[model samples]
Target: MNITKNKFILLFLCLILLLIASFFLALSYGNAQIPLDSIADIVINHLVYGIKSNDENGALYDIIWLLRMPRIILAICVGAGLSVCGVVMQAIVKNPLADPYILGISSGASLGATAAVLLGIGSTLGENFIGISAFMGALGISFLVLFIANLGGPANSVKLLLAGMALSAICSAFSSFIVYFANNMEGIQTITYWLMGSLAGANWPLLSKLVPLILICIFLLWSQAKILNLMLLGDDTAITLGYNLQIYRQSYLLITSLMIGTIVYASGVLGFVGLLIPHLVRMLIGTDHKYLIPVSALIGASFLIVCDLCCRIILPRAELPIGLLISLIGAPTFIYMMIRKTYSFGSK
Candidate 1:
């Protein structure tokens, strides 16, 4: 046991170092071709002392601090949050294929945001009406999924998945219906961008709210690591071991919904990070949640920072959507995994 624990600690340290390296690499490379030294200087000034400049170097500083930094941070936070939720969801449901979005939360958030934009249903709220609407939608769908899954018997993995899919279909249909009839060109344009998922809109104010929420969720889920390990043994065995997963499952889902709502509100539906990173980490470290959660978070954060850097530099001037980039990369990898029979969505 001690040896296993030591190995996990070593893996965690290695992942953290990798994350820092990726962060530096992400800061250094971009289309404008800023030198690594200049980037380092800006980061040092911001981190070490409060220095504000608007000169050429300052403009670079601003771009790094205001534009690129927030986006990178957003990527990291969203990646970590999604990966953490993915780990928790998989344990709760005892399904390797489970993800944070599997319970229809992302769809719900999307529908809410879409309605707010196209229909202007929540326009009277304020500047953040779209985000608020998204939160409500995600929460609503979570509740619906929980209720539906608990209908016949104990909330099991199969039932939870089915409920989530069904609710997701319903929310998607409603969103499309609103999009179809809405004659607002500007609204449609905004909706399209929101769907594609970009970190271009990252701002400090949003991050201030989002980062703390995500941190709290990560902490809560991390503390449940032991319980998550027991969950893989199935309900009957888990019950004999004296752990009641019912409340834990529901509570984690709700917390995850809150995190997902904020993420969707911040960066639309950035998919695959949650599903892929946790699975990959599990493959490396085994299914022990104690090691899986934090390590996956670090890997997820590093993965997005790199991916975002690619999206910035890969094009001539314009930026590509991160979600599209993830899909392009993830789909083929997923196919390869399926063909190799390494790990799959095979039923229990």
Candidate 2:
């Protein structure tokens, strides 16, 4: 057993190294034709030998640092955050299909961002007011869903999902109402683009807003591995074992809302990541959150990096939105999983 576990750790570490290499490659390759040798030289000079970009006005370094690097890091953060949320939600709700966005959080965030952009409701909050509003929207909806679900019962999985769906409808309608009455063409266009989701706006300034929150979410969820394991055993079992999951579940939902809100605000509603990546990792490593969270984080990050790279390369001088790309890839995989007839949707 120890030998098997050691082998598993070694294999997972190897995958992580490969993911890191892929992240670097993503930073190097883009629309411009920068040579790999120069890419390596530039990296080494900047790191091992503290050198600056050769051309003060050149774009190579800008592309590597401002554009590509930030986008890549955002991809990693969004991917990891979503996957962690998925794992935690699944465990807490005792349903494999439960994902962060399934609880109307994304729609609420969208509504908040839309309100900010269209009505200028929070313009006083500064440039990233949309992001701030979106985060609050997500958190508010999460709390509402939890409250409504737990109204008459212990908030089982079915009730939670029902509450989420109902709240999603309400939020979507409000968003549509805002868009319908808003007379700004440019605002409508911006909202449309944001709904599709892109890494085009990635920059250090924007990244700084989210990186700390993402790191803290990662650490907090990682520390809850054992609790997550217990959570999967159902609430009654957890209660019998003297572990009341009500507060834990609510706290986790808040954390998930915060993390996913940052991602949606940064890139705008990237989908399929939480739903797909966590399921894939569970298939590989079992339902133990101790192993599940970290592995899911690394794998989801790598998957998003590759997907973003494909988005960059798939077109000629035009880029596809990463969210659409994930949907395209994930929809087919989801269909295949359903058709295979091998695994139940939510089973131990």
Predicted structure 1, TM vs. truth: 0.93
lDDT of each: 0.83, 0.81
User: Highest TM-score among the candidates is held by which one?
Assistant: 1
Q: TM-score of predicted model 2?
A: 0.92
Q: Please write out the lDDT profile of model 2 over residues 1-348, one tens digit for every residue.
A: 012467669868987897888888897677876667777776777788877577752467777766788899988888888888888877767777778789999889889889988999888998878777887788889889999988987776677778898999999999999999999999989877777788777888877878888989999999998888887777778889999888788788778887887787787888788888877775566666777788888888898899999899899899988888899999899667656534333334
- Candidate 1 lDDT, 117-218, residue by residue in tens: 988879999987887888789889999999999998878767888999999999999988998999999999987877778888899999998899999889
Regions more than 4 Å wrong, model 1: 1-3, 54-56, 152-154, 341-348
Model 2: C-alpha RMSD to truth? 2.4
In model 1, how large is the Cα lDDT of residue 3?
24
Q: What's the TM-score of each model vs. the native?
A: 0.93, 0.92
Please state the error at residue 330 of candidate 2 in Å: 0.5
